[model samples]
Target chain A: MIEEVFAVGTSRIHRVDPRHRVVFAAVFSVQTAIGKEPAALILALAAALVLVLAARLDARRVLQRSVPVLAFLMLLWLVLPWTVPGRPWLTTGPLSASMEGVRLSWQISLKSISILLALMALTATMTAATLGHALHHLGVPEKIVSLLMITYRYLFVIEAEFTRLWRAAKVRGFRPRTNLHSYRTYAYLVGMLFVRASDRAERVYAAMRCRGFKGKFYTLAVFPAGRDTVWFSLGMSGLAIAMAAAEWTATV
Target chain B: MDRTDPIIELKGVSFAYPGGPQVIRHLDFALHKRDRIGLVAPNGSGKTTLLHLILGLLKPSEGEVRLFGRSMRGEKDFVLLRTKIGLLFQDADDQLFNPTVIEDVAFGPLNTGKTREEALAISRDTLHRLGLSGFEDRITHKLSGGEKQMVAMATIVALQPEALLLDEPTVGLDEKTHKRLIALLAELALPCVIISHAFDFLSATTDRILTMENGRIVLDEEMRVHIHEHAHKLGSKPHRHV
Candidate 1:
């Protein structure tokens, strides 16, 4: 559940200031993404997994949430090995699994899981509100921060609206089929959802204006840098640099 | 029945959507200080539109909207005027757009140039007033319908508006929440122009009832408690109830 994903708890990782978490996660994610050597990627993955454990996050839940991403990686693994033309690792009739392609797929899969785990551990422990405040304090534009805030807040609402429309369709004997009528109906439903959402946006703006909103968003929460904040950033940055060193050594 | 100078007034008001039929036609109304006015109208009536016009959210084709003794003509004027009159939307989801409840409630105070601590204090007090203490960090979208409604109201009252313009404030509330809302609203000492379809709620909350039909005020009278007597179809005896 979304609520469960964002539930606040007292853990060391959770106590790490949101600004530090955001910056470290972003920098580490970029490092992991650019990494090519399996040794360094493995180290990165291990570091992320250890963070998850230290955070006391539910590993099973994180895996469950990662199912869709893992599934997409599986698709890449299936297609890449047979499609890329290189020194074949295995051959079956006309299909050849290339060693280079397999290695590339492994790299992508490891990077994705490492970054995903890092994000869940470092960032998802805090509420989105905290993240927005962190982003604002990190010098992100107020407009962008507010946009993110509103989008995060209204996502569930729009999803509920979609579900309501879907249920209404279901009760009216609407059935999905491989037919033009079904496709048209689905298109119309999406169009209607957009229309309703736009109308809601207008009303929301009016509501904001009614409360003296003059094209600016203000949040009361402030994430001031404390001792823990500095220590957390230094620790995370050191780990990131170590990973980068590992990548360079492995390539050399 | 206490009345004073008009807090809200509309003169020769007529409104029409672009390339559409007129929604409001030649409507004139005034809400005085200490007046609790309930506007009851059927769906498709111009009740919400009328409220928007008063707030300067919508412009009437040919009319003047005077709020707190000043004619609202432009964006700058409306911007200043809006701080004095809070408008509660029909859907709480539309109103509570901040990531957290407290931030949403504090948005107005912050925009009005209050310090962060001051805004937080105001938000906490307002939420406490609405019986929502400790909901400061509650995710706005994840709240229950009733909680969202209360939080939305808290957002408005945090600004300390002199008047309220409510559009179906109790639309999707459960009975318990509805009663709580009525209680909270009853405690407010500000003028209000409430648009609602719930006749019973209107009867209980407002001092005057105005019924709108076809873009015009069809009825305006002092609200009085009236008992409805109805018999079950299978029973012969009439049951009296208020």
Candidate 2:
């Protein structure tokens, strides 16, 4: 039910060390998110596009994945241009679009898209399990890494349980409609899902204990450090620094 | 511990959940080496609770749990005992918490302090032994029910546990997988306390059978299959009975 559509690949980006990808994704995302200059944002976005191409990701799938962010950006475009109280760039029929507001909205849209594409091309190229291991190797807290790994593992199980419960409801002449009864039925279904999930959590914990879990999750994954990983890290670092320099120069 | 000593011993064990009635009542049980025992019980008969108590997942309010002739009183002791006694949960999903099949299978060995390389080797070996040679990189959740069950078994067996506590191992299995499970169980030399409802499966795999009711063992007998030929009504043809 939970598909990792982008995880399976045989490209240069896929072969890079997950740790390098994770760290560079963070560095590039942070730089893009904080950068105010159009020049830096455009550079970041272009770099992200290059990474996407290098990863050989399907352009159609990438666009499909970007739909939610694009929708959010559309909302921002609708609201921001008229609300920020600045010199009017356009006035029509009692609605005025402010220059500063439009600029702010544009910057946010660029930041969001650049970060999203970069993350998809880098971190999403590996499975969640690999990402968890990478985070651990990067000195993320053990508890957080454990939570990520365990949550990823059981998300599918809980989804399957929800599907079964929904099927049972459907088989019992239960057609959801716009009514109090339907609302109550959906609430009960969600409540039961939570109850079942918690019950399964207890059983899973017991099973872990039976297998000698001692409050520490040991990962068998190894991210081998190679020349490509080193070069990728250096190259990404250089690009990130360049983006930051452009943002500073534009600010000055 | 002597070879004759019980691998797992429960003495006067009685347990109740907080604010709940007793699920296990003055239960005394022992599992010795070379004993492949099948335990049959009705729903809510506390067969699972009993296994949990033995594994120290649930503590007994009245009695003590002894593992390998040593009394295990606290969490620390059970941590060590768990490496020696593996329990296969009825739901494979509960047992497999890792993303990939090999990682899930290697989890036990890793938890027991094996190096990553050693654990991977053990996991590969275990999967190979279970006829899942090429399933190393498969996502655990994407596997079929029977395959998941076998992989769960591989996780437990990878630890090289001395005994196994299997809860309803044959549930949700197809005929072929069920036959394969029986064959696998027969091949394992470890003593097993299998809680199952399938009488024929128990008879085929175990040497001793136990029936539990009301949180206690009601019948203990040698595992035997009685076959007879019988005719139904006047004109019906005779058929072999199981």
Clashing pairs in 1: none
The residue ranges of model 1 lying beyond 4 angstroms of the native Cα positions read: A1-7, A79-99, A224-231, A249-252, B1-5, B174-176, B221-224, B227-242
lDDT of 2 by residue, B1-242 (tens): 87778999988889999999888888888999888988887788898888888988888898889999989998888887777988999899999888899988988888888998899899999998888899999989889998999899999999898999999998777677788888888888779999988877788788888877666776555545554455567537432222
lDDT for position B132 in model 1: 91
Predicted structure with the largest lDDT when compared to the true one: 2
Instruction: Please name the candidate that would achieve the greatest DockQ relative to the true structure.
Output: 2
TM-scores, all candidates, are: 0.90, 0.93
Q: What fraction of the genuine interface contacts, i.e. the true contacts, does candidate 2 reproduce?
A: 0.98
lDDT of 1 by residue, A1-252 (tens): 256563477777888889889999999899999988787899889989988987888777888989999999999998999898899999999889999999999999999999999999988988877888889988899989988888888888888999999999999999999999999999999999999899989998988888888887766766666776777788887888888888788767
Per-model fnat list: 0.98, 0.98
Candidate 2 — which pairs collide? none
Docking class of 2: high
